[model samples]
Target: MTPASPTPPDASRRSRGSIRKTACCLHRGYPVDQLARQCDFLEVAYIMLNGDAPDEASYQTFRETITRHTLVHEQIARMCSGFRRDSHPMALMCALVGALAAFYHDVLDVENPQHRALAATRLLSKMPTIAAMSYKYTIEQPAAYPRNDLSYAGNFLQMLFAIPAEKYVLNPVIEQAMNQILVLHADHGQCASTTTVRAAGSSGANLFACVAAGLASLWGPMHGGANESSMRMLEEIESVDQVPAFLRQAKRDPQAFRRLGFGNSRYRHRDPRADILRETSHRVLAEVGMSDRLLQVAMALEDVALTDPYFVDNGLSPSVDFYTAVILKAMNLPSSMFAVVTAVGRTVGWVAHWNEMHQAPLTIYRPRQIYVGEGYRDYVSRRGERSAELR
Candidate 1:
């Protein structure tokens, strides 16, 4: 796939409007690289949901308010317990998030500005808890509660990794890297998911409904599941030496041995988030000092993909998903959890877009389609098949 050239923004509105511009792979007006380097996810999320950056007092208040809502209702856990233990985390995440609407009725009044803010805060805060708990449900491990003392990413790591009986310390390096990942993915203009949220919100569906609709759209492998597929691809390669053979197969039979995690419909030359995560992935692998062969394979694969003529000719530069798989693997996260983690990062974007849609003159989204079927065919009924006219 050829990468897309940056589309100049509609200057009069100052909005990128879609993923093609994505504010130029930037958020608001702040460059994503700057936000990834300088700001925490919560602060960046604050800036996104609100028009202005928060002052010291406002930021503290915002962070504290969000932290207060991280814990979900007890029944949410009981509901999760009923699912088969083999359930994928992404499926669990989507189901649990949709279930939130039943629990959070007070925040349903989207017309009320206060209610909108509260709804966004609740989703943003509780998403980590929900995502972590979903993973625990799959593993049949006891779910961990949110910790107030930890930063946003630190709390997530603790909830996923910490056992009450065992003292688990939070590592700053890991937490910072995780926060960057979250911030980098917080928004990317519009998508099938974000558009779903917009359409739902236009009809005054509450935050959970809007976000749930969005998440369901994101569940496909071509969308939020790319990182998971990328991880699976690396695992298939197994050893560094096998990467060349895999590439050869990919080049020969592109459809049968598909390539992923490279190229984008957004950036023309490189994915900005990929640039950020490439460096972060290295830092994480070195800091964790893991002998994980998959990371080694990823390193080799990345090198080949960057240099290979086939990839370069197709403008198949590594996208964020490429290194995201590497980073998550280094953190010992399973491939199954990759999309779940993506949902965690994307909740902010979903909420932000939903909020924006409500703020504007709302219009319900109806997809435009071109008919491609055999047109003007006479209705015919055969054996068991009923004609449309009968209905």
Candidate 2:
């Protein structure tokens, strides 16, 4: 008998697994690290959406457009007030954004460029306000309204830190650091949250609902909450001296150890964002005149992990989450607020990807999976007969 022909390669599997070209490059095709060093969040957002850096006239218009939409409807604020004070900020944000569809159905037209633009601007502007409102609601503080006179980052800082009967000055260092964080996180190609956004948008869903889906996906610990987990891990370590023991424990049972921010799935080398954030974290911490033991432990842990043979061999390195926890902590933001901050920055990326998907010729996203299970068999209604068949 002739030998059986070799099995044909699974083209579907290969195609599904293959890496595609990335289209989220910053202005002039600069890398994110370089872009983070040069541009603020608004400029970066403009570049991501428009495929070019904005000129002076366009930049002013873009900034003004976003500023105009910073205030949400009074009903949305009342809706946020209904959530329990202890509710997770991200959960509140997801609900609020989803509810945006109910209030702004006129701008849900994906086929209309003007409607899409307005929707994007509204989301980008109001997300920070919504995030800050969530925080104030959780702490039972009266919501501090947005100040359009301030820069975007400055306005967010005011909303978060300003309170009645006190003038809160925006520190230049903190404002710059916050802007850098937002710009660096503005877009990463097909990240979990972005993929979620795209998948939802594939159904021709309203922009607000699609973005709300992305926010929900980002609430997972493995994604946007990495910084919060990383902060918690650092706090647990408590001191630099304990980092060695922590590392040893991690080596033994990684699953139980929960190394939150040391590695990234897509970045094999040091994450470009981490480098910029490290510098910014140090600068901000020093400027604030803060000396945090947890920050020290985090730094030492990163140092040891980078030098350890096991981590080096396994391609594990500091990711953006590593230093971001420290930076946010230095800014006096609670660990609970970390993911909300991430969502605030990532909203632009979600909007950009949603627009891209809507404008493309792509159909609805329906991924196939390989089934490795028992073949079809007769259904036995009786439990006794089913058990006997199994035996």
RMSD of each: 4.7, 5.3
Could you tell me the lDDT of residue 5 within candidate 2? 45
TM-score of 1: 0.90
lDDT of 2 by residue, 1-391 (tens): 3454498623211111112133123333656776788877888888778777889999999999999899999899999767888999998999999999899888988878899988998999999999999999998898999998998888998999999989989999999899888877776666788888878887788899999999999999888998899988888886788889888888887543435887665655566677788889889978976567877787798788779998766656667887888889989899999999989988887787777765655477766556798998766755657744776
Weakest 10 consecutive residues, lDDT, candidate 2? Answer: 11-20
> For each candidate, what is the lDDT?
0.82, 0.81
Candidate whose lDDT is highest: 1
Q: Highest TM-score among the candidates is held by which one? A: 1
Which parts of model 2 are misplaced by more than 4 Å?
1-28, 253-259, 382-391
